[model samples]
Target chain A: MFTNPQYGIFVLISATLLTSVVALLVAVPLGLMAAIFLSEYASRQVRGWLKPILEILAGVPTVVFGYFALLAVTPILRLFVPGLQTFNGLSAGLILGFAILPTIASLSEDAIYAVPQSLRQGAYALGATKRETITNVVLRAGLSGIVASIILGVARAVGETMIVTLAAGQNPTLTLDPRVPIATMTAFMVQVSGGDVAVGTIKYKSLFAVGMTLFLITLVLNIFSFWFVRRFQEKYE
Target chain B: MQTNSPAVGTGTAFYVDNTDYYYGSFQAVRDVTLDIPERKITAFIGPSGCGKSTVLRCFNRLNDLIPSAHIKGRITYRGVDIYDKGVDPIDLRRNIGMVFQKPNPFPKSIYENIAFGARINGYKGDMDELVERSLRAAAIWDEVKDKLKESGLSISGGQQQRLCIARAIAIEPQVLLMDEPCSALDPISTRSVEELMQELKERYTIIIVTHNMQQATRVSDMTAFFNAEPTEKGGKQGYLVEYAPTQTIFNSPQMEATQDYVSGRFG
Candidate 1:
């Protein structure tokens, strides 16, 4: 459909949605558990050393992660799964999830830590086990912040370009199949902006249009985050 | 020094023998030996830094939550060593409940606050009835029965403290440790809590830590006064100065320090 631009644009949008969905599936549970471990279980010395190391994953260049996905993850995935392509959304989305993991984990850790110590004491006084206190009290109190972090992670996954472009290949297909090659909206923009398309042409113009679409998606998520926090956040004095 | 007054006829509930509390290397309170009587309101009265609250927390093993805090001696509840290797603080806390200086209700609704303790302790009874019974016993049922779904924080501070009390009692604990429970309340609220103590002592043993000497005299059957002296490192070390029936401590004390403190002549 690259020869037919209209159909290709639709394919690019679907690829973006599919990849982001995959990324969130990988991130949410892993990130949240990591946050809880860091906040509730880790000693001060362990947290002091471990938190910065986890954040360092966020600072690593996306280009490096792109290559690591292409060269490292895809080959390993190919050994287990049948019909897996060298450039597939599975590998790209998995790495994209890792790339944004620290955002969710770090922010969520901060939120869980921010829950007042009195609440924990109150739960303990009631004979709540550590797991019960965390799940019943701490998680409920920190829900708004935890959700906000996930939304921010979603924005990062949606806008992520280098990993999908380098690892997911330049094929715009209207499919949710992770094992197949796909090109996200960001990947399409990268393709058009490489000086291959002439100025003022349809392909070049589509870059700005796709950029606006990405902006709107993230803007909607952020606005929803604000509304959600206001609506559901537990008020504590 | 230990005091087992003859006026304590109900039998001993907690036996604290030569206990020394420490935060890491620094000793906070030393050699605190006392017998707290069952089904009675025992007050620990002292100035700030005297470790009254610290000793109260030790009863429920709530002080175990602090990483560096440790105790050197024995604290037994009904002849069971609470700090024994086999003892789980979680289970011990079910038998012994605590209320803080600040009224700390969960951010959940009023009904949820009362129900949470019961639920966690595996209460299979009707939750609605349990909530009502607990709130009624705490004397806040009339004020809060209408707004059971409202957040616990939505109420006034006095009502919130009562709600916390209701939450604590919902699990039907055998003992209740109150650490300056009325310190954050107004005079009226304090009076109400003091009265509640009078009623609660019929069923459960109570130990309170308070700065108000009058509160000790008004509510407690027995009183233990703690005094703190500065160490060489400039941190205060708390020790039990006197323990006896509240009447004797206030009217005919054994120690000069107890006399000075009860008369407001010394801290």
Candidate 2:
């Protein structure tokens, strides 16, 4: 399988997408809620303390996060689930979500904060409650920025190598079940690069093929983000 | 300063008495007392930093949005103290709406901009009919009727201001507080808005704060002249100099300050 370039490429691609989906599930809600709280509800003193702490999460080394996922998160999950593997997609993807959480939260907070104060005032003068104002006015105005942050998070999750390689293992399997071990495109690239493969061989060349595929995916995401922002951005004077 | 005037006449919508507004102990306005008559245009004219806008905001408790802003004395709407503990500012704002100096339409379709307020206030009637009625009332229906689905921000500045006014009135508030609503508009737009105010006064009590004294004389039935004096702390403290019928305010003001202000002597 190490020499056969096409043996498990389908499984690797599927694992990459599945894990990214799981990561988005963990990141989007928590990150968006944190952003809204920071931008809207939190006092200046609390925000001063909290925003930096959340950003510090983004600065932690990914290798350390990988080990933490493998050693700590997987062990905890094993206790809850009936059959959880030591090297599984769930724990790896969950940790990946945390890895990208700050990316979404910080960017989304800036977007929500940038919405003009007059819009909120307009909503309030119309008898809208704070919740209604936030959902209808603030969120809608910040939609383009929020969507951009989520796309960046998805890109981060898709391209992340160390965490998946270390925790989700190097076993490529064509399955969506996260309780078992899986391999992502990035993990395969890492494996091929780290092992003793000849420069001219198919296995070594497969790395570039996978790298190109990853690049294309992110390029598509970026183009979509550009289009989406142009389509939905609320211009304020 | 004469706080009350005989020329102000009958039906009172807002009774503001000895109201002192403070932003964290720095007095912004003091001893502002006036009766805003029902279904009439009452304009507040003052120089910059005289707190005409501040007094206007207090009508709907819009100042409550500022963390450090607090008021002393009473502001009553239709006989109820708006600042009372049981009175919800949300409900109070519903009964009394506002239009800002700058036109701020929601970055939504023009239709949604009007519908949003009505929807949030639990308007259970035919939304389309309500939208049309509000737009027609604001006198922007003919210009924007065909492009209802277009972004509210895509319209002209004057049209956007009218849309905002339509948005405010969609929920059917009894009083509309306008803070320099025409300051950001062109002369034509200002004239149209002034005309709209004349029409709107038949149904809703209207209070407008304007730097343009001519506007006050032109649109208001009653006028309040506010003056600012330098305090010991070097900050300006605004107080009402006089309240009278627009005719008296412009032609026969009693106070020298009001006379000088109306005659373009000084702010």
Candidate 3:
């Protein structure tokens, strides 16, 4: 039932920081590309097929994604990296990335579609190709929404538990290597919840402290996303 | 063929030879033929859905964009067939700009909106000068110069229409086609746009479609009247009724429909 208060607090803070950064770094680019594919490249028929498939990926239990990360993804990484750890942050981050793809894609698509059709026609009438029109007009016009989607994806990644618990290891080492099995805040919460700490002790209080840190991190991301979207939504009429 | 008029005042800019337009088996315009003089304002006046806009769209082949629409017959630009197989619609549209009835400006800065055509054509010259010159020509420069970086939608309806005019003129087209350009403007804005059209005809060949007979009489030197012939299926089919000098058409129109319309008897 004993817990070192200083080490517990430090572990909680570092894990929260690492998880937030890893989530954000993976989500932004994947989300932007998803938005583009869904809004611009996909035909109506393709969209009808692809959108539901993407949402299903989001709806799938995170534990299943974690299981796939452990059995399928980590093994594949080992073949390439040779010394890759069984439960590493990279696999957990990748699964987390996939889990949040629909969030980013759907929100960003809504933003892009919200841009007035007149602006798009105006661009095309000026002889802009589809690529130029999407990049210069559609994407730029919808950039705020895309940014908001990425932040929401980060929030989803930060709050994730079962996937990180299964894929990311329990060692709270503050290392940046993707090949090493690194612990995240959500993983620690799940690890400690499994009878390793008694119900009414400082060790249990540590869980809420970590939960508070996770909540604060996601809250900041959500606020920053709101600010970013508000700042850019001023362009379109 | 007849005694050639002074070269300064007589050259064909647009020549329509037996042109026909159809919307998927529904004929919108019949075998119509006419000549529009260079640096002249030619107005097409007609009742609602009388193929005036269809003919105007034919100048730039905007009709081709509609999947169900088809065109047969030759439209010539100074002697070259505009509908030739090798003609790129984009290039043709660049040379033949168009403004719609409703104001349609890019949701960008006034400067970028004017510079859009120039940029698309890869004009890397001093964009500031080109933007200013085009806006000045469209008669919107004095009003929008201070707010060059502001969004185009922020402008009033009149200014937005003029901004569209400036956007069209920025490409430095040989001709400007207006499909009811003043239909959405106020009286004062309409007057300003009409005056701008008059000044522009000295440089750009202008074709305008209007339902307003007075607009046709006021701004155009040449007027083409179109009438909707009643069909069996409870709809009207459009055909060209007459084409002549505006004064001649208003004073002594040969077609009964033209006289009826000008006299405000019926559209």
Q: Rank candidates by TM-score, best first.
A: 2, 1, 3
Which structure is stronger by lDDT: 2 or 3? Answer: 2
Between prediction 1 and prediction 2, the one with superior DockQ is: 2
The parts of candidate 2 lying over 4 Å away from their true place are A3-5, B1-10
Candidate 1 lDDT for residue A46 = 93
- What lDDT is reached at residue A125 by model 2? 97
Candidate 3 falls in which docking quality class? acceptable
TM-score of chain A of each: 0.97, 0.97, 0.90
Best by lDDT: 2
Whole-model lDDT, candidate 3? 0.81
TM-score of 1: 0.95
The positional error of residue A61 in candidate 2, measured at the CA in angstroms, is 0.5
Error (Å) of candidate 2 at residue B256 is: 1.1
Clashing pairs in 1: none
Clashing pairs in 2: none
- As for candidate 3, its clashing pairs are none
Q: Is the docking of candidate 2 incorrect, acceptable, medium or high quality?
A: high
lDDT minimum window of 10 residues, candidate 2 chain A: A1-10
Docking class of 1: medium
